[model samples]
Target chain A: MLNRVLHRRTSALVCSALTAALTGCGGGVDVIGYDVTIQQTSQCTVTGAAARNCEDPAVLGQTSLAARWFLETADDGVSVTVTTHEGRTIPGLLFDNNTNVINTEGCAGEGGRCVFVRRRYQTSDVNTGCSTFGELIFVGHFPPDAPQRLVGRFSDVAGNTEECGTPTINEVVFSVNGAKVEQPAQSLEGARP
Target chain B: MNRPLPMSPVLVGLAIGFAGCAGDGIDFFEVVRSRVDECAIRSNGEFCVEPEQFDPPTVEVWAVETRAEVALLYVDEEVWVLDPLPGDADPATVERTATKTSVVIDGLTGCRTDAVREVGFLSVVTRSAFGTTGTLDGSLSVRSVLTGPESCGSTPVGERTVDVVSGTVSGP
Candidate 1:
């Protein structure tokens, strides 16, 4: 009975130590999915497109969804892609390792990794659209040695053009806990010829 | 003391013929000048002169799979890559070939910014083709921002739009 109690205590101590190490390093935990929150701080209007402090609770919410996070590393740079099950994809958030900074922001100062985020949304008119491009700072150590996980946050004003009807400008914050997966095959159906 | 001599019609005709030949020769030289020469003559931007001043200035054109074509302009140490605009295509496949034009100075300090593609103001004048020698012409207004600690102290550095105008990329 004493031997059994000692064995149980050792196992519990080891588990606790492992948990502390993982949490302290800000990594090594494979989360099920990402929790994303997007808030539009500016009231979007076509008439007078000016930045005014407006908050809509309907636009501010959180969702947990299944996503596929892919990381491609080259000698020159590293790029990440997050594709959700709903077919909403954020592609090519590139972090050029060759240069120590991305989008004029120092990655080394922020713990040696950064990704430049540039996303565009357009209307069917082709001429009507808005672009959001800025720096996405890594929360913990990025480009993990195993290439399995990524955690980052972004909170900045996205600039947009006037032709986008109203500024579809928004502030996005996301935390991704990605797992390693094979490169998805490109589908030819509905592809532009 | 000398009376005006009557000019021979044949001599006058020969003079006119020689002038016409000289004019034709000038036109031929103008038409046959290489694209590099044309770029030198027409461009007044820093990109035009720096490439020539540096050693091993070369302009290379290659395709990015089936998405778009790319042009690389390399001087002694500085390099600039031209990123063309993707038209009605999947942006994911052509992200590198898309509108983010980048430049690396001294092979150390670098900056990448999206080209301000207004309707008529900023556009690629000529896009280089794959496997064939071509010329690249356009004006790009890139945000003057540098990356890395090596670039933090670089001169003329600020967060402003720097206009690189009348740039031409052609073979050495």
Candidate 2:
């Protein structure tokens, strides 16, 4: 049913499998209806409060590349979001909320790609209160070289005359159900696009 | 110019004693500290006088992975020096010190909890005595807000300072 053979940072992949399986389409395909082939090329960690804790493979969309689950691309790169049903974590609060912007376009490199990053952004799967991660939504304004650590200089936070630079990208590759990612993302689950 | 004074057995013995001060009967780091003083006379880069006798304490090290690569960070020693004021009688006069501390890095190694960030504050070398020594109970202050695709949709994660305290290095 749940092909747990996916890649690094356990949380995101497990969630992806869970999210996909909830629809009842068992046997190796994801909820959005894509064939599954787990690739071992990945690195990820769970961030608790600070310093991105270790072991949650699906924590960051860039590094872990677990964004394939909630990623909602409307036939074009014109808009991007990850949402769930309930849409609000608290009563009268926005759960499927694309409310917080984590970063802004500053100099050149930062604006490289994936413009306008946001966190706790809810776009699909509005089912409320599923588990610990149910309320948390993640998004990344990614550049081609998405996977990374320490984007800006750590010293910059010290407010010194130092400016942080994006670290070198190690790897970034997207795939859809055993096939490479293509525009219009091959009709979710072969039926519900 | 002061002319050389005639030397006797007692003077020779004393000279031998002074030169031998760096040999033993003192902190091995003192030997290293002296080497630093001697090297600074010719260069500006940091020169640690790791004495031959110095029992280097072990250090804890760690690493982090970025998308395409892995960055390693570790605990190490930081050194500081107090320079002599300008126009002083002796311009070369100065004091040196060391502190064992930790900070975020691409990668790091060669430090341990048992080791001290031995802060050495060396005053002008007096003929009658060696320099003084001081230490802060072991402590460490390091932090970073790593922004990447690891946390949430290209957001910053673990962006905070960590304060660690140990014996001898009180931490800052």
User: lDDT (CA) for every model shown?
Assistant: 0.32, 0.25
Mark the regions of model 2 whose C-alpha exceeds 4 Å error after superposition.
Answer: A1-193, B1-10, B13-135, B148-152, B159-161, B164-172
Over A130-193, each residue of candidate 1 has an lDDT whose tens digit, in order, gives 4434333333234535334444543333545555454445444444444443322211111111
DockQ of each: 0.01, 0.01
Tens digit per residue, CA lDDT, model 2, A98-188: 2243343221344433322233222332353222211222223333343221021100000111112221212222221222233212222
Q: lDDT tens string, model 1, B28-133? A: 0001111221112111222233334433323333221211122222222222232333465432333221122222232223332111111011212223365232
The regions of model 1 sitting more than 4 angstroms off are A1-62, A74-99, A103-114, A117-147, A154-168, A181-193, B1-172
The candidate maximizing lDDT is 1
**TM-score of each candidate's B chain against the true B chain:** 0.22, 0.23
Question: In order, what are the TM-scores of chain A for the candidates?
Answer: 0.38, 0.23
